[model samples]
Target chain A: MIPSSWYLILSAVLFTMGVAGFLIKRSLITVFMSIELMLNAVNLSFVTFAHDWHAVKGQIFVFFVMMVAAAEAAVGLAIIIAIFRTRQTLNVDQIDLMKF
Target chain B: MHLALFLIFAAVALAGAANLLLQKHPINAALSLIVVMSSLAVLYLLLGAEFLAIAQIIVYAGAIMVLFTFVIMLLNEGVEEKTHGSRVAKLLGFPAVTVFLALIASIILSSETHLGKVIIGESITTTQDLSAVLFRDLLLPFEITSVLILIAILGAVALARKDEQ
Candidate 1:
């Protein structure tokens, strides 16, 4: 039997790596991928908790989270494409039109 | 057996995530993310979330990653340029994150005793049970998510098309 907390710890480590990628990466697409990483980490924990408690709701919640992630990814990539079309650059630093 | 399997895949997932961070190109990062997602699916399988594991593979590794890869190829973007970034963030960011990670790990380890253990193939949530809960208990959210996907589709179309004069 593997302790469920180990899964949670792995999730946390993945989440932190996602955070680091999001903060440190310069490209728009890579940062977006970091967001996806964070979402996946959370899904792991949700499944872990569900298994720990022998409840199905956690998995159900993961399902919904995945749905939301899909929707978000579609719209976000579209927005990235739009920004790239106009800006002609994928760098987040260069795409800062609203920055004062 | 379960512990060994979990450790192996967890290591794979962590390595993938680290590579995602280290890769300078978006396509490479995206591919690494796929590795992480696949390993995570294996982890989910070990935890007996069979349906979710499959969904993770099909939805994440298959559909979403394809979308990401397509966008990367369509953009034809090159490697990421290095920026010095903000000095304050450089000074404080990693340490802050390390502190946060330590705090979270300590809390989880403290509660590890009672949080219980998961045996491989112990409690399988069949598709029927999953669908019953999804369609019956959470029907409204289910329908709403459909609408959300529709909105997403429409938004993507609107966003991607060229603006008319």
Candidate 2:
């Protein structure tokens, strides 16, 4: 079995990439995807610790996180669709209607 | 064996994440994100979280990404136009994020938290225990998730409907 810390290192790397994507990407949907990637990273870390501690609780937390992510994805995509209809564009720079 | 599996899938997940970030087309980015999620499911399997691995595939890769792709197709917004932010931000930001990752990795690596070195047996028993906890202790949260999903359904329909006045 690999050391649990290795799993954590991988998790951290995935999370950092997610954050960079969130910051550097231009589309609203890509930003949303980045958020999902971040959540996946957290889930991975949780599972790693769950394995390490031999407690099922961390995995349960991952379960709850997944539940919440599903709901968030549904609503977030709907809002994105609404914004697209209103703006006809996916560029985050153009999504500045409330930036005044 | 397990180390090799973890290394392979971890590479897949990271590469897919990078692809998601670099792709100019939202659809391509969404597809890359799906790859990330699927590989994460496999990693979850390697970590002995059986149920969660399946849930990651079904709910995340299957449901959530499909929703993203549907929205992408529905929006039909072609490749994103390049919007150049101020150069200083990029100059300062990329390295800052790299430093942050390095800091986090160092902390995680330096930690001496050793857990059950005893590799557990089949996850079949794990699943049974998980279900017991889910139904007994976690019932409230489980029910709440159903309500959250219901609200999401209502909200999505309300928002995406034609705004006929």
Candidate 3:
């Protein structure tokens, strides 16, 4: 019997890695992937809690989260394409027109 | 057997995440994320979320990753160029994030939250069981998500289309 906390600990670790990638990486696509990683990590936590609580609602929440992630990815990638078209670069630093 | 399998997949997921961070090219990072997503699906299976496990694979690994790869191919993005980032970001960012996450991990481990053990192959949440709660108690949210997906599709097409001007 594996301790549920181990799953949570793993989730935390994965989420941390996602944050690190988000902070360190410069490319927009990779940064977007990092956001997905973080979402996946949270999904793992939701599943773990679902298992422990013997409730289906947690899994239901995971489903909703996945749905939102899909929608976000669709709109977000389109925005990325639009940005790439205008700025002609995927680097975040150079896309600082709004940075003032 | 369960513990061993858990360890193996967990290690694979962690490694894939690290690879996603380390790889400079967007394509390689995207591939690494696929590895992470697949291994996560396996983890979900081990946790007895069968519907979620399959959904994770189909939605994330199958559909989402293909979309990411497609965009990468369309853009023809090259390897990332190393830039001399701000001294604060380069020097303090990694260490700050490392310390913060370490704090969070320690808090989680040390707290008395009482997250019980997960015995594998027991108490599986079946697809029928899920849909019962989903379609009945959560019917409104379910319909709302359909609307959300519709809007997302429209938004994607609108945003990505070439401008007439």
Candidate 4:
């Protein structure tokens, strides 16, 4: 039988990559996607722990996370669209209107 | 048997995520994310989360990603421009991340024995139990989430349209 540690480890690796991408990528959409990737990695860890403990609460938590992610995505992308309309650019570095 | 399946899908998911990071075009990156999400759905199935697996596909891969692509089209932002790579990120960031990965890998591998193996259930019995818990224990949070989604939809509609003076 495969140990649950493997799944957890993979989740860690994915989470780290998401962090790396979030820092390394400049595009707003790519950064946004990295956030989703991070969420998915967390979901994987939750499922791993759930399976190890034989509990359904982990999956239920994953459900809540997905719901929140969906809402975040809708609002986030709409904001991105609005930003692009005004600034005519999608680069987070270039779209720095908040910086003084 | 299951190990091989897990490894294959894990590899695909990892590769797809890597592709998402490296691709220059947002659309290409978005597609790679979809690949990652789909592979993750299969892994969820293997872990006995039958309902979550299907929901992962339907909600994340199906709806969220389509919204991303739609926004991409609506914005019409072309390929990402080259940034003046941050000097701090270059000198310290990449190596720091590598060290972080190594640290996590050692921690996980060293503690492997403490964590128990997942006993795979033969039948798809998770859906019924999941629903039971979700409905009975989590009904309040579930209703609040639906309300959150409604607010999000309204917000998106308001935000995406042309603003009036």
Residue B17 accuracy (lDDT) in model 4: 94
Over A6-89, each residue of candidate 3 has an lDDT whose tens digit, in order, gives 998899989989988887788899989999999999999999999999999999999999899999999999999999999889
Cα lDDT of model 2 overall?
A: 0.84
Give the best candidate by DockQ.
1
Q: In order, what DockQ does each candidate have?
A: 0.78, 0.67, 0.77, 0.73
Model 1 stretches with alpha carbons more than 4 Å out: B86-89
Across residues B89-148, which tens digit of lDDT does each residue of candidate 1 receive? 446678887887899899899999989888888898888889988899999999988899
RMSD of 3: 1.4
lDDT against the true structure, per candidate, is: 0.91, 0.84, 0.90, 0.87
**Which scores higher on TM-score, 2 or 3?**
3
lDDT of 2 at A79: 90
Write model 3 residue lDDT over B11-129, tens digit each, in one string.
99999999999999999999999999999999999999999999998899888888899999999988876766533455878898789788978877886267788888898999999
Model 2 chain A scores worst on lDDT over the 10 consecutive residues at A91-100
Model 1 agreement with the true structure over A1-100: per-residue lDDT tens digits:
8789999999999998888888888899999999999999999999999999988989999998888999999999999999989899988777767865
The candidate, 3 or 4, that scores higher on lDDT is 3
Residue B93 CA displacement from its true place in model 1, Å? 2.0
Regions of model 4 farther than 4 Å from truth: B86-90, B122-125
Q: Quote the lDDT for A82 in model 2.
A: 88
Greater TM-score among 2 and 4 belongs to: 4
Evaluated at residue A95, the lDDT of candidate 2 is 78
lDDT of 4 by residue, B19-78 (tens): 998898999999999999999998888888889998999999999999999888877768
Using Cα atoms with residue i matched to residue i, what is each candidate's TM-score against the true structure? 0.97, 0.93, 0.96, 0.94
Interface RMSD measured for model 3: 1.3
